[model samples]
Target: MSLSAPVLAFEENSGLDTAESAASCALKLVRHDALSKADLSAIEQLAHQPAARHSGNVFFAPRAVAASASLSRGSIDWLLWFQDGRLCLAAPVVISRIASFSLVRIWTHTYAPLGTPLADKRLRPDLLFEELADRGFSALACPLLETGSTLATAVALPGGRQDGRAGFWSGIAERAVLTSDWTEAAALSAQRKKKLRKMQRTLPLVHRVLRGDAARDEGFRQFCELEAMGWKGAAGSALKQSDTALAYASELVASHGAQDTLAIDSLEDPQRQGNQSVAMVISFEIAGRGVVWKIGHNTDYDAVSPGYQVILAASRRFAAENTPIWIDSLAGPEHPLVGWLWPQRLTVGTLVVPLKGSHAPARTLSGFYQAEARLRQVARALRQRLRR
Candidate 1:
């Protein structure tokens, strides 16, 4: 598919009755390198909207994503969604293969856990699907979507319900997200609580949040160094493991810092020889919302559970604020530590949206989803058994 033209146009449904119906929508296909300065500005504004910000996704931000695409060495193709005669959403997608099926899907990488697109408002997925179907697409495979989010609701499968497009009540289950009111899961054991209490008192801590260029840079260095001192480094998965990963992280920090959305919070051990940081967390603020992006700890301080401590402390502070706010852990539901401490969860899932008039492919993919879920469950069981 050549990237030079608009694929489809539709009547934008702006609420005002007097609004001109001539305001039309076009799903423009643009490559990353082809994006103009004006286009970047528009996308930066789009990142401020709920679909991106509420999910704590900085990846959809213009500068941040450009950095990502450059380093990931992948094709960066974007479908710019225009609704109400205005740019409503922007997301990179690929018509690629999955189990012998060539499907249109939200482009994703290992580092990007959530595949939610950057949308200014709720978009009608049904309309988008019909348009794609008309354009020869079979289905849209959306993975890692927050089940209750704007993009998810727009694309969730309709079960012939009363409200056919109610995504708040639909979608397949994929993962769990930790939200503000996160204390909803079953309580931890008394013994476990007592152990954690003991761990907290083990280190006399000075919790600090670093901003500004100099301090934030130093904090980032500390984080990478600490992470490299542990299993992540040995496993070749730490930020310092590869120059490309390091550059990507650096670019993200710089981009978010310029937007006043980046912060490095750490818990320093005052009693340590030189007041070393025991745990560090790199986080991004999306307006009032927050995302805990990366965390690292001094394995020597494992007895104190420094990583979890800093995160919980941050969560407590968030909850203590007068204004209501939510933060995403950015960890998968299978993550042991995050789910245990933060009990409230956001149901995330993959949706297979069958393009209009092309029902077979979507049906096949739906069956594939079921089988994949079963396999994943079995894999988890095997892991548990191995651990035991």
Candidate 2:
């Protein structure tokens, strides 16, 4: 699973040839520690500034914190910096090996929804993918990518096709821009404005979103309780109680806190008196990018649309800061929330590549793909039947 010298050379040699002026920047692969604290801080600061692209929780800074926390089990080999002296590129080439397999996977450190190339929007993926292939990674998976991202546009598989799925989902805010003024943002869209007005009118009826203090030990407990009482518990879902899952959540929050951008918003109302906490949405601010992680709402409060209000409130608050940020709902297109929030799509998918000179790896990948295809077919059929 180790990165060979040839692979590293291939990645370094692949450079962007896009027509954009920003594409002229030379791409460099350096050890994770190559980024000086001052340089990292500068990038962090610039990422938070207005008009900065790809500044979110999953960039280099947060990754540094998360890695230091010892929570991430995977190894972080290098930080891919595509820079031109002053302007910095934020995409880090994270290398990790799959268990029970000899294949190594390379990806943009995009574990969360906010993960994106922290470079100029003009950054090209063709060069990045070429470098990734040259690095000899068996697969390049970019999870939770924004739908219209330049990286997504640039990446092409060996067969000259993109490998990923794009969709929306319910219970989360879609990709959206928070304006400089909350009031102005409220008026930006007539539909959104109308919904906000309605929610505001209904706010008197036991509806309010509360931000919890992560410093308090009870913060995680309260979040878990609300999440359990909402959906996970009733469904007996493993995500509610899984230590691995909880660790990931805690890690992301801690990482965000280190960057001074971690936020937890919970929906509470007296009318929904069964449980004080109806819905909880966890968001991380990394270098100014706002990414909504896990969101859960009590089924009991679903009738009143409490989740939507909480999201709206959070969005308004973010907009008031005048920071260029994106709130990702991180759900499939068919999600109920997509209907109301109308956040733009953030497409994401797992990229799988069969290992060369290894019939075993290729065979294993083929079986996995076949199984996945079957599952997708079944899901599609089920969905079509449900539509009837």
Candidate 3:
């Protein structure tokens, strides 16, 4: 299904209202097809800005993921709101039937770690939820929500109604925003200062930093090589054993590029010769927000902590630009990196609403949600371990 200019068709009684608000206008839900190419381009441009919220989970944020999801059997939709015609909120909604329970389930980029609604920081949760409910969705499921997100707070309110019967999965959303003054970051922690000092001393010994679109291809290869060596090289690891997983990573990288979000910062070791890209950090630039996607280093260089050094360098670059961007190290709270870095935690939650008159049985829906929560718990545990 090639969605090259799809029109958005809303069902009658669809909760969304196109009416503008004087205080905080009504929420608008536009289908993926209804968005114009220019609208997409504008959103993409905002995503790349140094201060915008660039979430990979949003359908329109990265073209590759959006296109791939569109082709899949799963029903994927996009929701957005405009303020005086300016894009304010954007989220990708994936609807699927839980095979065991036969219940309709909706999620945003289930495969990724952080799935926050990409919207203007000023957006209100009540307004957003009212729009969502109007669209005919009874519940919203957000796995890997940060600890204190406005969206999470909104969903847990009276109108939102929390489902206490079904236990929730918890994950940490580690984030730190770069300020105009890079030096202010030093106040964050003594350990951060120590690491910065060590990296500053060691940087001259490693290869130079690779920047911009010109270096992306080579940088991507280095990132993959480092990633493979770090995790996939381990026995029975998913990345090593699953071709689909590898393809997924490659697809994300490719799609980010097609959508102009791919950003790489790498360090080569000139002292050690021949075809080895020792340390690399891959990040996606969205809405001026820098999301740290992945980082890897040659274990051989563990003594020097090359991976840590690469990240420090990248952070400094953003700081130097004086950009109000957050380095979203989207990891679980238990992860050592998250704890040590001490990034702010934002909470997110899943909202499940039962379609009142669906043909599907209720028992089926209950079982599906149960299984979903369990699966989420397992995934969270594994992710926490990886951060260590």
Residue-wise lDDT of candidate 3 within 19-69, one digit each (tens)? Answer: 534244545444555667766765665454432443333333544445446
Task: Compose the digit string of candidate 1's lDDT tens values, residues 289-348.
Answer: 666788888888777888877877666555664144566676656676676666667666
Locate the minimum summed-lDDT window of 10 residues in model 2.
Answer: 2-11
Candidate 3 Cα outliers beyond 4 Å, as residue runs: 1-39, 45-62, 67-73, 81-87, 97-111, 120-135, 146-204, 235-243, 258-261, 351-388
lDDT of 2: 0.49
Number of the top lDDT candidate:
1
Tens digits of per-residue lDDT, candidate 2, 108-174, equal: 3223434445555544444544444455655443343443444443343344332331111111123
- What are the RMSDs of all candidates, in order? 6.4, 8.7, 8.4
> What overall lDDT goes with each candidate model?
0.64, 0.49, 0.52
Clashing residue pairs in all predictions, respectively, total 1, 15, 22
User: How much is the lDDT of residue 351 in candidate 3?
Assistant: 33
- Taking all chains together, each candidate's TM-score versus the true structure is 0.79, 0.60, 0.66
Better of 1 and 3 by lDDT: 1
How big is the positional error of residue 34 in model 2, measured in Å on the Cα after superposition? 10
